[model samples]
Target chain A: MAIKEGIRTGGRSARVQASVHAAVRELLKEQDRASLTVPQIAARAGVTPSTIYRRWGELAALLADVAVERVLPDVAPLDTGELRADLRAWTEQYLDEITSEPGRNLMRDVLSSACPGYCTNILRGQLQVILDRAQARGEALPDIERLLDLLVAPTVYRTLFAEAPPTLEQLYSLLDLALPGQDPATLCHCDHRRR
Target chain B: MAIKEGIRTGGRSARVQASVHAAVRELLKEQDRASLTVPQIAARAGVTPSTIYRRWGELAALLADVAVERVLPDVAPLDTGELRADLRAWTEQYLDEITSEPGRNLMRDVLSSACPGYCTNILRGQLQVILDRAQARGEALPDIERLLDLLVAPTVYRTLFAEAPPTLEQLYSLLDLALPGQDPATLCHCDHRRR
Candidate 1:
């Protein structure tokens, strides 16, 4: 209650939210989602339970925030003049992040909640930057939005459903097919491309 | 234990599994994942808790089976002579299924599990059938495996992450780009094609 009653000191609110968010993440690692209580999170974060309840309303809402901001990696855009190289680099990076434990957990938690759109914004923002770079280089890309969907959805699908995450070769293969002039023979093999 | 021991009769095992599985789904609908217990599922299914524990071992495993077999819809392969038309029909069908509540739940549950490859086989099997048909018809398709990813992944990604699932139009555009010679002006609009 003391923390919540305190005056807003220019981003101090953000600092408090960050600490609460970090506490939520740490608690999650050690306990199951069902067992987690707002009071417990509040205690762990050194804030009043009312603060969490007032800010997030429910545990799922708080988890959604953590998933988007902290759990999902911030993917920087890559811009090689060639679309093939740029695409492979970006896809691999994206894949690696999502396949990690925290990444997978965040994605799962986000999907389970009522609002999946929160994660969508994060995914779209990252992919849009990459596509924008390719477009600037005069690549005759497909519908930029659709191109992103094509590039990303299957990996998520495979990752969620399949026994293994698609190999880097598989990602490169998809890019080759999506973009013109990149021969599959050269693109599908990650090892071949590097050499 | 008695239930499991008494299941050697014809179709009895199936009936018991079905009842147990149905009970699991019903219980999930009423409670969050963390709140669910084997005894609750067993009681709802009219079986002993030990039967459930012996069969599934954990809630996640049971949910995984349900997700793979029942939650995710069966996507039949489309075989329209034109690749553009076939892709549009297939994509729309797939999108509608995955974006639904059951589809979304199944996906989230599966992703939460250690093994994601299970869904990959389902996705791959459906896509492979479509690709093989296209190949048989001699369509100048992109790399078959990559084509599957390009066609399916982005839709899954956008559906899971974005505010709106990829529209039929977006899917058509991606297909148009992937398969040579289909102009976006003509493709990418399902409404236009229907008319």
Candidate 2:
């Protein structure tokens, strides 16, 4: 997040940017994405929204960047030396944050107006970072993409769109099933017949 | 649905209520739940919003009723003696719809909101009708609630929030793995290693 924020050549210097980030986090904690308009954000940050507009491109993009940057830092790097354990830990992290009021509320807002293509980009971009980091040291590079989709799809549907929430145990179990031997490609096609 | 709509003095007129059902669905397709004003619906339906409001109370409640009534007719009766097959068949109906433009757009609209609880209510009420009907028929209903969540959650998360679309084959494989005729009570635990 610091890295991304530092990328901008901005009118709002370091002090102002810090204030803006603080205000964004405040709105996020409140889980009031709808109420966090540019003017409101400006008021919160003690600056004009023109300051916000200058720094971040648009309303959605600003929120999108903030959401990804704030949330992603906490979820990366789960190396337990065992794929199943690592996946389980990550799943728990993902589930806990997502199921909470803040997480669910933020996800609901993002998903409501999200474009399918943009969604794919953000997910692949974010999850890929985690996947690549997890598999960076390993020899047999497996495609976790399909398995990630399968493993997490149900939870997202249920949480964001369905009636129930997928429990932590379910998430761990799904990850275990998906990463039977640190291999999602093979696991995806595993003989999942009625046992 | 008819039973619920029967409330609010809309007595003994099935024929009149049918057009309202179609109008809600049509209106929903064109507008987000938030943007959908009663006047817009009335105009489209060739009736006044008052007429629509008089027929159905609050906008949310009216929309909710329409949602219940629209999908209820399409759900396959659980008479087919198999759980996996029945769910597969049930999910199969909307495979294309969920993946295609309209379904995908509507899904994105719903999830991008920051209010999970309200969204959950609408989804739960609608999906539960199907699940309740299936369970009522006496098929070995194991984790019917979670299973339904598991089925729809992943795709929605991926499509709406993550931006990835699941192919029918992907959905097929998820169902195969998720509801495999094992002790569904076990999977219902959703916890891999158990507490």
Candidate 3:
């Protein structure tokens, strides 16, 4: 999907877009992000500064557009035929990807961008797909917001801010909490009284 | 506590620290952050540039220091003689402050800083105090990590990224999910299959 609606996506426009995105990716690997400028990016992409500005508005917007494309899942979440298992697999894979070096950088770009909601919507859409499949199978599930609050939020928060990302087992426990009738107690091994 | 360990906190040092921090806060209100330079801050604070460089090391470090001070809780979370009530009250107040304009700006500053974990630790410390008090009352409660994963993480994540900060009622449901023996289904009014 286009990062911004109403943008033309025909042949030449698409070619310029790909070249500019590739330039951004290459330059990010080569230099500090704060040093990246539209003129510099345009020069590297073999396009004029006006073209870059006309298409993407500014450097932050350009970076955000690239980040959204990088982060959007290329395939639907795997169907495990069970809601909990499906959620577990999806979340674990998400955690792994986001905690990687490039993933973390993309996350910062998206968050720092003017349109952070694009990335948020992408994530919410993925979870909604999982929840919808579960419902189709006659399985009871918590609402999408519940999953966002308990599952996606924590995973992203820990990945970005904590000393380390949540473990696979911790991801399972969070999924347990979000799914109906799953006893989170059985999955939790820590003593409640221990501070 | 000092933002960096071993920094002197008495007399001239304290005065310089206050002045420099005040300068940053003032400049942030007065001008675009990307255009702000250490020399300008030092000029405004009436301190030499070397002094700022010596103490804070750089602008991001200085900004992180100021953000931590701004975001840290000024008082203990109020006690309501019950674990759930206490958590709910504390979280509601936390949400209010973080979602406000100044709070939102401070959250961005902290997240963008070089030492994000300082702010993270401050938040964790506050939650630990609440959990400790609940434990003292002989109330069964989840561990500190559980609180971070289920409550604090989502609160921070949504405040920073979502379309709007979560509502007090939504905060209540999350607290319900975190506390032992509390049925989240009872508090969540939305239909699970609706989405």
Q: How far is candidate 3 from the true structure (C-alpha RMSD, Å)?
A: 6.6
lDDT of 3 by residue, B1-195 (tens): 236532235788889988998999999899998999999999999999999988877788788777666755457778888888888888887887787777777766766766556656767777777888988988887777888887778788887777667888887777766777555345333334244
Please provide TM-scores, in order, for all candidate models, with all chains considered together.
0.64, 0.59, 0.74
Model 1 segments beyond 4 Å from truth? A1-10, A25-33, A43-50, A67-70, A73-90, A127-144, A173-195, B1-79, B112-115, B180-195
Model 3 regions more than 4 Å off? A1-62, A184-195, B1-59, B183-195
Candidate 2 TM-score to native: 0.59
Instruction: State how far residue A99 of model 2 sits from its true place (Å).
Output: 1.9
Estimate every model's Cα lDDT from 0 to 1.
0.66, 0.57, 0.76
lDDT tens readout by residue for model 1, A38-62: 8999999999998887877778878
Candidate 1 positional error at B183, Å: 4.9
For candidate 3, the chain B TM-score comes to 0.71
DockQ leader: 1
Worst 10 residues of 3 chain B by lDDT: B184-193
Per-residue lDDT of model 2, residues B137-175, tens digit only: 664444544555456666555555554556667776666
DockQ of 3: 0.31
Docking class of 1: acceptable
lDDT of 2 by residue, A1-195 (tens): 122321234554767867877888898788676667888778998999887877665677567656655554433446776555555666676666667776665564465443334434444554555566556767333356655564556666666655457777766655655543433332232233222
True contacts reproduced, candidate 3: 0.42
